[model samples]
Target: MESIYDEIEIEDFTFDPVLQIFQYPCPCGDRFAIALDDLKDGEDIAVCPSCSLMVKVIFEPEDLEEYT
Candidate 1:
């Protein structure tokens, strides 16, 4: 079965007004979630901090999905 991550296309990082959060998939196969209130523009990448992995928070429209 396909995963949710493979069902939808993910676009570049954009501020989600409704959720007020920034969401993106990291290169480490993990999802990186950041609060919009805690982020600043021009910040596209961040360290996982927890796992110490380099994570990119931005992606093209074809990079996201809703896997099950």
Candidate 2:
């Protein structure tokens, strides 16, 4: 399992339509990415592609309707 540093508000992340992923900037110069399908399945954590950091996304289920 990965270590979750803290919870990040959903408003902090941005969506990419082409990639269909939600991303937030990481201190490592990489980004934390969580797929739409994963979020729909009740997965809240997103990890950076370059590092071992992860954060739990704070959002309600209904928050995903706009993306789905």
Please report how far candidate 1 places residue 56 from its true position, in Å.
Answer: 7.1
Q: How does each model score on TM-score? A: 0.36, 0.92
CA lDDT, every model vs. true structure: 0.45, 0.91
Residue-wise C-alpha lDDT for candidate 1, range 1-68, written one tens digit per residue: 21222222224444466776655555666656655434444444444434544445554433332210
TM-score of 1: 0.36
Please report, as a residue range, the 10-residue window in candidate 1 with the lowest summed lDDT: 1-10
| Model 1 residue 15 CA deviation in Å | 5.4
Q: Report the lDDT of model 2 for residue 32.
A: 95
| Number of the top TM-score candidate | 2
